[model samples]
Target chain A: MVEGKKYRQFRVNKHLKRLMAKHYALGRYQRYWGRPLHRKLAWITSGAPVELLRAFKIYSVYPEQYGAICSTAKATEKLCQAAEAAGYSQDLCSYARSHIGSILRPDLAPMQGLPKPDLLVACNNICGTVLKWYEALAHLLKVPLLVLDTPYLPGELTEHAHQYVLEQLQNMVRQLENLTGRKLDMQDLKRQMARSAEMTKFWREIRELAQAHPSPLNGPDLFIQMAPIVAVRGSQEGIDYYRKLKAETEERVRRGEGAILEEKTRLVWDNIAIWPKLFNFTKMFTERGACFVTDTYSGGWAAELASGDPLESLAATYTNIFLNRSPEFRARQMIELVEAYEADGFVMHSNRSCKPYSLVQEVIRRRVMEKTGVPGLMVEADMADPRAYAEESVRTRVEAFLETLQAL
Target chain B: MEDFFVGVDIGSLTAKVVLVDAQGQALAWAVDRSGYSGRDVAQRLTQEILEEKGIKVEQIKVTVATGYGRVTYPAEREVSEITCQAKGIAHFFPGARTVIDIGGQDSKVIKVLPGGKVIDFAMNDKCAAGTGRFLEVMAGALEVSLEEVGALAVKAEEHKAISSFCTVFAESEVISHVSAGALKPDILAGVCDSVAARVSALVERVGLEPDVVFTGGVAKNAGVAKALSEQIGYPLLIPENPQITAALGAALLAWGMG
Candidate 1:
């Protein structure tokens, strides 16, 4: 096996760790400060309109991100088993299974589970499983649940679909007003959206910096640096963290410093990361001088918020998430990434836990390869569940994929 | 001193070593069960082949290793089986565009260019349902010798259908067929079809092209080759000694190093 040199780390990672730590710390002690400050803590999905929650002065935490944490911490298998023991099928999303299992067995969870939520918010733009997943959460926690239904876009985002999502956001605001005993603050929402748009722009720029020869970042960097964007999207802290990340990434590009010591092949990644083996899996590529210059998963958060009315923008932005779009759009997105990054090839993680993302990958892979004239390799593994991963099989595919690229 | 090149493939079930002259002509080869240590078995096989050819270790220009145990074997270079399979197949069938290889534990389909350059490929995910191990288990259940399985399956008037994709579950299905008075030949034919069906899906993922070549130890089973060919609607080209192609490819690659 060719053992490639270790990838360089950014100085900004220290700041990133501190920022994420503070965010989690605040959540862990939310009860003490939250009640006195009249800020309600609500558990929200990653795709939910978090800006609206911010507008209502609601403290939001992400179970989806927590699921990723559980996986990285090596607690996912046990947590998933706990949920399975509780009648949840093993076939369910590993994230949902792990999060629910954390609730069932806090002792096995990282931080003994997230601070109890006063309410639960879910959006179906990411997947339909979240609807049932959150519904189950509401029943278990005996909390009010608010859902935003985003209609799937078979083609372009139709007017009716936009209006439907806009109406749901309005209803969610009303429900939030009732839950928090606060009024909908329009100015506050505008400010939140502005911060979100700025943070997203920084993230997009950080990703674009990789377009330089020998990309400034690799797959793990993208996955790790995306934490604040996912956890505190509309917050000033999130914006500040991204600014530092953008500067560090820019400096790497300015110095012509690739993420790894040598980048013989540049590639694009598709789907969620294999968190349980994030570093190990990435090492297989880096060891072969292959760097994932960009990816569709983290870049999902880099799209700028739509302009115009803040509410409509939130509606459109949240509803038109790439996951909810058609395979044609996804194929185009991948092809554009390959061209934009000048990647040699691409790899799609056929994540067993994510049906919406994994199901159409083969179709998108073929289309992208045909249009871009680059090879795309498919690897079957779960995003969080290590049990689904086969080390030997994955190694073979990765090696062969890299060998093909080298041969070319 | 004559210049020689050697290729060693330490697979899950068998270890193969192929020795070639400087001109890339096959000189000698051998195969043996991988047993508990494929690397050791591969080393032993390589030594035996060299001794048989009366070629000393220093006479060999390069030794390239491949297969699952390629990493652990001592060699000048190690390449993946996919690349080796493509190189080996292209050497025999220059017009071959696709290659299907079923080893002991995994199966893969590779799309290759004219010169054996791999453009794309797909493999069976962490499952034993469509591999040589799957066949060995079924053969054990049917009380049929592994070598006799293909011959018996070919004579079946009507083949049974094995619905389960799991190896263990498929074995139970085979046992139930026996209890239901199904002929062993018919049941064995079902086993081949089941393996073929699983591999056929993988071939579809890579998109089969004309002049497909079948390699790996499983290719020795005529029953699977016929079933897979029928399923994909394309005749398969099997090498005389199918198991050693990867080793031969490795040896060919070693020759290129000079």
Candidate 2:
């Protein structure tokens, strides 16, 4: 079947669909073979330390990704209502609220909801909301919860912060050992970290391929493709997938093929993808030949993993995740993206779902515009919930921002 | 042969059309409630204005569409109201460094550059609290006309405060204030002050500049203009026909295209 002309199809989309299908299938039927294979299925946050869990032969499931899937399935409003009925505040993170709703009523959820987890792991490096979210999950599922708290870094990494994160990681190892009944193998962990680092590097390189004129990739492509790196990091399958993507992307760049037919203006995107309307909303830019070459959202997975002892390296790497940093750090990162990609302008998604990413965006927007002399636009919407999206308002702001670039 | 340029602005509550000649002089313009169909209103008004001026459609060199319903119009080109407002204000006041536009559904604060381009801008979130709609709703609740609210508000010697920034909540608050024996003009003054406070927050986001140009339907309200000036610490320069500025900006852009 042919796709619509409104969007240019990516060559590797079929492979991604197959990979995600197989991954979800494995999780859906995990109860049948998981116990025999001695692999415990665990629910985890997107920013949690997955390598440590992988070393114990644990299968990881990302509730955040599943929440996005539910949104794409157009089941978020119903699922969120279920959660709200159960006393969860509507003001809470939509991902968490929806996931909680799915948990309370799996019959109304997609795929009859995710398989029941044997345990839960959460890291506060992403946002403080995860701590409370995972705590609720742990209580409901009656599973042990492992939390690795990464203190917010105002500026440079202090010695106390390093010791604090490393100490918690060391304590987490004992809990994992007790749960899995496996000893911590230093060699096995080293191998996992190495694979994880290589996979992250591959992603970083794939993003750089977009630096080519008429970028080989667009925003939706990046948002969709970065899933495996988050879901199955520290695994050979994830690395292999990225390797093929890198090679394909490089080929596209070499041939001067772009994600869109013509790239008249290059833009940088901030915040998370509007999952429910990803294709529809992105067409607003691609149809105008304004391609989003890079984004801060998916780039969160491409941060280089530090090299050192396994626990200490994980501490340094995960603690400094972009979402946990100060606004100055984010501003500098955005300015660098504008300069590095030769971006004509940038747009900030004032996402209502994620406050840590959305708040202080105006300040950052001003700083980037002042530094780059490129106009910045703010579009208010939610990452997963379609209800928050105001189509006409977003269209006006984006159309205006694009016109500003054309005038330039 | 006469060369004509046209600009059409289709907002949430109203639709406006402006026609200009090759030399950029206004030929004819019209404003009416946008009603249910922005596309229909824009098409009909453009036709009426052209016919009223004895001009043929073929004489139009270019047409630019703007405002909330901009994309729905089949003009030669479409632009953002921010850019259109900046261009429109700059055409009249060459020194306009800031623009505060309070339309029916949304409010915008734009920082204008030297060439009539928008350097940066901030807009109200998905709410009607800080916009012209808030005032219109308050006027209805007070049993006063939209035009009378502003004029009557200026008569209040001591203005009371309306604490809520939400339109629905503020409506109820206004009702209770009236029941509590608060003067009608004082409550109206408070409503204007509330809009000014909300708009001030948006303006602060973009950073204020001197020679601020205030345009849009709300600019005709002396109460709002006065309160906004007090909050911004500078008197606003409202255009003679503030409601048609965005449409004029679109016409100016159309002329530039020609």
Candidate 3:
């Protein structure tokens, strides 16, 4: 009934809500269910190797996702202020700040601040901030902290980086095992990796389905649907979820249906989503008949797991994360998305809370423009903090960018 | 019935309205302070423009609203200030390849291709450092009118550097310079140069294109324009009345292609 909502809703939205509700409810009442099931709940980063933790029978919860939920619930400003009051700088990642704030002040947090973690796991494959965030959490919660340090790949993953990550992953196995009082199950690990690989493949296929004319999925859809994959990847539930979502997407593509009624312009989105303004932002594009055919953020989870030994493969997969790579790699990835999706243009979110992602964006924008010859529009905002979102400014840039594509 | 098109740009500081015929020629234009009631001001301006041109409401075929308060104002359609500025600049200067628009609240550098198309753009983040608002605050700090600050800066014999580009911090820096008995003209010059430097960085990101057209209210400030031109190393071609560029572009869009 909104004025700017010209796009069709995905039928799976109800299913997604149900699934995410169940996932969050599981985390909410983990103290009740987890103890009896002999499962340890570990609060992990989005990019952490959760499959390994899952292999150790640890139920993983992503604080970053919860930070988003907190943001969507309009609790980020208050939560971030709480973190800032606790000596955390405002310049830190908003997700980390808000999560830490929730940890410190659970009364003001969503879901009473993600059930107390039995252990904490962090992987620096996403960003360097996670290690420090998890470190602070480990110190606060007095829980064992396991860290996977994936070295940044300025270029190709060298033998040294691969070995370094593999060693840490192996070390992680021991740490997780020690914390859970369980031995490493090789068969279970292999099965989990297989499921993870399958789920990633399905996700990739679902994204590729956007290559179809009038894209089956828009930017928000990709961002929202990617939740289960990030939180519960390598599980049967995740695999089944993606399988269903991908099938419906394929059906949409087959039926020649697009996320928006008339996909006049197709675009590629970069950086993490503006969680608080996802729907409103999506409408800005969709209402103008612009559909984001693909994005580099959600696609980070859709990367194919490298082949070979489980630890070695994860080392390659996680270390070679698009964010951990060079700006050259990022630009190429963006250009490839633009080309693959046949995008008319691209929009880069110059997120304020994310330095690693936002800092090199201008360079990436220039490179993408030179290579793809498609215009790249950079709009400034934050990923989680609604306070940083200037609705008028963002709308101006997006509308202009869409008009540029229309002119072309 | 005579067909007309209307474009209203309700910017943070000012609201602009442009009326054009079906052929995209500007017939009447108006600019007024936006104040707190942008929607009311925009409506008043639209009525004024229509009456001044002796045109009835029914004669307006399309209305496109733009700028920061564009959403608040009801119109037949809405467009972003970026596209409007690009279109307006292209209408005046067909060879325009780049546009630098510094409004009251935000500053933007747009890379424009041939035929009024914006290929790329980079805007200042949620900061008021390199915008008209920055200059206004600085002007107030210097106890001079915003209009006089520009001409006064042009008469400076010495230029001092303002280290902080942040509006709040820079205000303190300006006060400190004043306390140190720095010449008012020099301080004003430094402020203009600082804004120019900050905006030039954004211009470099989108790339510096020849025949760069500067639009928005800040373009009227001769000192800022001179400093900006020097920073980018390309002379800026400002419109006759730079503030109405976006509004004009919106009106042109409402007029549609010939």
Candidate 4:
């Protein structure tokens, strides 16, 4: 206790309890760090791949996820130092820098008996930083490496990409055979993809189910749906999982279930999940009985677009959807998702680390409002880098946003 | 028996390890998803290979680490990615003076001076538009895996380049191409042309040389590497574990570590 300071420790905690409730993290902080799977070491991580790892029960670490973990508990500075020592420029990806630093210095990125990954996996879908970042790591580890490839299709994926991609898929299938020493049965693979497609359809239908006077789906459940969607997207398990989800949702609608309290507003949310703190985001609305009618994840079901045409469908998959299209297409898709789901407002996550996606999000937001008259909120945060996420500021913004929506 | 050395490159997407004798002769290599424990991953993989070859870890002269995990490696010293790449490339193709290394996390164009010193370099570590990870994610958008981008790109009938450097914009463009009824192979070829064009532009930024060697993980892609080679008017000298060039350079640096 400072003798002359009546308020040294009393700083900032006052206003934080006030308006921060609206954007206050509504999710519980569950510890995911524990015993890992019986597996090889090494982790190739992008922001979204963290969820994939969780689904596969893979014991890997994502530096951004670690940043999220660190920020929630306040340990980013030390990690930052370690990265600096590794000769990694401080200006690079903060998450990557922190992770690299941790790798360069063990005390910072400490884990239990850190084991190396047998393989590394990365998809350039999020950003290009990962490839070179991984390139360096692959060399240091000297482990068999694998990379998931995507061609840049800024305006639209050409029809040629379908065949191009299919051929690549065949190659990947072979690569997997070499890696896992487990054969991917054609029947099983097809069944998995079909199931995933089916689940996507069911989830899409459930998103539609929210069109009633009171939506059948709530924010809480809306967030949980991402699991099957992400974990089993190209496999049958996702489809089977979504089937059960759709059935239960149908029953919930039949029984007059409202996910949130009073079920008054229909909101459309566009952006990636703050997985490190998802429950908080959902709780902010669901406790209010606000049904989140639509999201990009709901529209991730282009598998049916190529239904029965796996090879061709796979090739054509990325080119046919708004999610994979230009910002104009995405703008239009957001407009449509709002209309189809009859959302009353829009919540757009302006994630910082993901500048590419968030770049035109404002344009999309304006277009959506002009096209649909639904107000949108541009909630900013790091896709996964905790340093970029301003929880207090976002909470304040959301609270005001909901107030305005309620006034409407 | 001569001393042996090991190099490991741990990236955001993949982990790779390479083994070499004192002469820098490539022995064994592995690539895997790095869960954690990159050091153990490196040590164990090296051990497994050595054991298989009836050798021991101590029998090896030195170990070096590079990529995103170089310094933290359980080794004597860590070298800059640029330095390691120069060494790795020089070892593979003695005549090489320039190198283009595209990995999941970053893309680098290096000007290798005589004696494996990096004279100058340019790198794109921010966006995926021109890096390997871009192709990885686009694979999903294109409905393929990371490994298949090259072959698919080779099938393009029309060379329509995907012009967007931004992945989001590219997504929109890819969808439009698909809906417009363009042939899948043609579209894929366009993307390949686009990626190669971006890479070529980067390479040109640092000034290209007569003999350019493409290192890093992407060099293994027969399609894209070949496309890159054609675009640059030179043959790409890719090592068996092309991704490990940076780490091998670091491992080779072990010779200087003491």
Candidate 5:
């Protein structure tokens, strides 16, 4: 049988599929894996070890978590420059740069000369760029790649799209069998999907704990805990990792250990973090006892949304995200999270490199505030391109805005 | 008995209205700063352009709106700027297959199929790396108005090209060069060269098989357009009102539908 253009459909999900490694990372962190530290900071390097842990059914780490790691570490220049020199220009994406760096310089690898991937898995939901990036790497490393197809259903996934995703999930099992040289029992895939469903439900509980008068965990802490969830999601390891992270979060809530900052004002952040300035920005908030209760970066959920019906859930999780939607949809999403978390303000990052995400931010912010009476502050910066961020400019704007929000 | 079809591009910074007669020749057009009220602006501009040409709005077969602000006014159809530019170039120069549009906020490189369908394209909307907005800043610092930026560049035979790819750095770099007594035209040429280098990368990405059509507000600058054409090794066909190319394409789309 000849594979045609339709087979190319399966490759679209390669981005999210490779991100299953984040679930693997989550499994590691949840169980406390090899104690890998990238920048010698407990939170920064905790993500890489979580990747290994999930393989042992320990934890899962979010890929974005690693993106955050590279952002704050500020050492991704060589790999990004190489990618540009190789013909991928600034128009691509920063996430593409980090992956290129990961492949070319094992020295830049989070593991730092540690073992490379035993397998490569991907999903198409994050963005189209990731699919091509992983494909390039898969060709370079000569590894069997497993892809989970999710249609580009921006607002919501239709029933047809959901069913189609399930069929793709089943087909992936066959691909896995061909590469691993072992037949995947159908019962195993369904069971793994069920475990993921359970874990996503548990993860939501941990986030809702933030709804408690004061957030049980701060933005930085949630940023840390997100590791296990990303490392091993959709597997027993991912399920187990979130189970532990959930437990830790709940225990904190039970003991009334509110997220470090306690204040009257709360804000929801949209777009990517300005890493070079996160320390300065975090201080701006932490010092004032203000909490960034939720952000679009921290918003994507493996919630009940992706539960019981693995295909429906995967489609639900991928298609209905900040990146996939028009500006109107994005505004609704930010507004919903702010209202759910009962946030007082919104700080939107007008990212320089991501036009699709950043273009309508001003309109979204204005419309959201008009409808909901929630104040919104806008900041300009780049997600991964350091050249786009101006530290002094952003600092002055953010500090003044925070002060005004406080006064309100 | 000549009828006209119009394209109105409501851009982020400007609103442009272009009218094409039955033969595809653009008869007249108007470019204005986009105001807060787009619907009002579109209505008023349509009257102004048609009256200016002594033509009535009723004589127009179809009207289309395009641009970032195109979304604001609900039009006959909201065709994408990508599609509009490809079509606008195809309509203007029958042999034109490539278009380099450097707008106020973002820049785009488009490739047109024979029928004006966009076969492949690339854009640099996320940064100021290669956009007219960057030059607008450079023009400000050099004390040589934006209007003379392109013309002045044509005269500079021995000017140092600014090395700063960043808009912020380029501003300061231009300042230092001027203080050192560099000719305004030379600095302008250097800036035009910088924009050309960046635009060329995107054009190459789309596999630039000419004839090329340089259309945008920036294309009005003879020096910059000349610089871009030289860099690409082809003479560019500059439409009469390049700024409304996107909106013109949008109007053409509406005419096709009706």
Candidate 6:
């Protein structure tokens, strides 16, 4: 277990281990079963329409998720160095750099790098970096590449923007049909969407249970528990895993147990997990009787699938991701979270690797603090790269933030 | 004997110790280069101050530590410099709403309440550009003593503009000015301007409020002080001993603990 000292380990973690282990094991040995079944493994982004890929029977693997794994495993620095040695700029997204580094130097990578892909799929909803990242992967692995171009939503999702994404979804279906030599099965897609919706609902409900007086979940729990939601969405295994997790979380709430031993200050987190320092960094808070009740990153998956026909829903859901929205929208989202979770304050990671998420965070933080009358702190660090983390500086900021909250 | 409280602020470049009595009145304070071990320097300073004041070690009821070396220092409590600074400022200027503290390695702007509670804050992110270290580097390049930087800078008729935000690049900018036969005071004024510009951006993050109190070691620099006041369009309220405010704040908090 990756659980740290003073942390309450969820019993469902065992089920999660078995579930993720089986998932990775299947991918690691995909050649044996996949070739016989005419299934092709496609490297996909975190924000891609995985339901559509699952419907086409395409085995989807997430390099971004693997980047987090490499980080937690403590192999990201070496992998990122390897990528940097190969002319990738140090300023690029650490996940992209680490993943590309894994490709270039598998010996230095965790799990000897993610299994080779038959094709690469990327969606621009998260960031434009994924498109270039997938393109680089396609070049290196000689695989077909498919991209979903979701327009940025400065305001609400316009009808034309929705139609544009829907058109791309249609085109992607045609491409998948040509690649897999299979017809578009509307029934299969509907079934996949249903499972996806169910899994998303369970994840959302589990997170909301933290609204209990003493939060049942902490930052690391949210980050670690989000794996299945990101990697195995729309799958029965994912649904089962979340169901078990939801029940366990509810039990903790019923018993009034916090993820930490003593919950004094409840906070909301912004940006991706500092995967390398997840436990170590969070320990600074947990030891001080602080618990991150909710966060924006893991909650990204908790959003319900958009309401529409399957294709239209996929287009809207994928296009309207929070990262693609304006700062005002994100600020309101944070304000609502602070009110709902009863958070004393919020901490934004200001992740150096995620421009879209971190760049506008100062604006959002000001708005949230102004609206909610709560303070927000920004800690600058990369989500995957350990090089960018300044331990002393981060500790100072965190301690000061908590001190202010306690003073209030 | 009356109870005495001690606050130690072991910063990156300096270690300071302040002693206060039962009623939160400052009795004695000392400052010295942090050198190889700030904690050791702080301990030595604390011992000296207590001995000088004829107070025994047992008479010290509470000890609080603040700043980068705070965690390592053996104290009754360790508070962050931010909270300490705000408390310190509030003690001296209760109406102060904003604080701009540029220390050895990091700079921060804090918005505080009436009683020194931090409402919000913003600090320079993993960069030495807007800090005292930035000025030290420019001074080293200009062959000027750290103490003389401010005095010399204020003498310049027109300040040179040091455009680079990176300390190393800004140092080179200083060198270029020197090599170009520009006056030393002009280059030094530019250095002050550069630090002020960088810190002003941090101030904007938390926002500039009335009765802005500027503390930290850099607050002693007259040139940067003048530039910052003009840039932010508000006069700064600097303490008599700017560097010891956080230590003073720590001492006050220690007294409060009693």
Q: Which candidate has the highest lDDT of all?
A: 6
Model 2 spans with C-alpha error above 4 angstroms? A1-7
Return the interface RMSD of the candidates, in order shown, one decimal each.
Answer: 0.6, 1.1, 1.2, 20.0, 16.3, 0.5
| TM-scores of the models, in the order given | 0.98, 0.97, 0.94, 0.47, 0.54, 0.98
* Docking outcome class, model 1: high
Colliding residue pairs in candidate 6: none
TM-score of chain B of each: 0.98, 0.98, 0.97, 0.88, 0.89, 0.99
Residues B72-125 of candidate 2 have per-residue lDDT tens digits of 899898888988899899988899999999999999998888768887788888
lDDT of 5 by residue, A41-60 (tens): 01111112122122222222
Q: What share of the true interface contacts does each candidate keep?
A: 0.82, 0.93, 0.89, 0.00, 0.00, 1.00
Clashes of each: 1, 0, 0, 125, 45, 0
Write down the lDDT of every candidate, Cα atoms only: 0.93, 0.90, 0.88, 0.62, 0.65, 0.94
Model 5 RMSD, rounded to 1 decimal: 18.3
Error of 5 at A101 (Å): 2.2
Error of 4 at A257 (Å): 2.0
Interface RMSD of candidate 3, in Å, is 1.2
Model 6 Cα lDDT, one tens digit per residue, A113-203: 9999899999999999998998998899999999999999999999999999999999999999999999989999999999999999999
- Name model 5 segments beyond 4 Å from true: A1-65, A113-115, A146-149, A234-257, A305-322, A353-356, B1-258
Q: Which of candidates 1 and 5 is the stronger one according to DockQ?
A: 1
lDDT of 4 by residue, A194-245 (tens): 5545666776676677676567665535654544454334444445555666
lDDT per residue, candidate 3, A1-408, as tens digits? 235567667777787788888888988788898899889998988888877888888888999998888888989999999999999998899999999999888899988888888988888888889989898998998998888888888999999999988888888787777778899888888899999989999998999999999898888888888998888888787788888898899899899988888888989999999998988888878777888899999998988999888888888888888889999999989988998889988998898888888889988988888998888888888998888888777777777777777852
Q: Residue pairs in steric clash, candidate 1?
A: A4-A287
Q: Residues A131-200, candidate 2, lDDT per residue (tens digit)?
A: 9999999999999999988999999777799999999999999998999888888888888899999999
Error of 2 at B175 (Å): 1.4
Question: What CA RMSD would you report for each candidate?
Answer: 1.7, 1.6, 2.5, 26.1, 18.3, 1.4
DockQ of 3: 0.75
Best by DockQ: 6
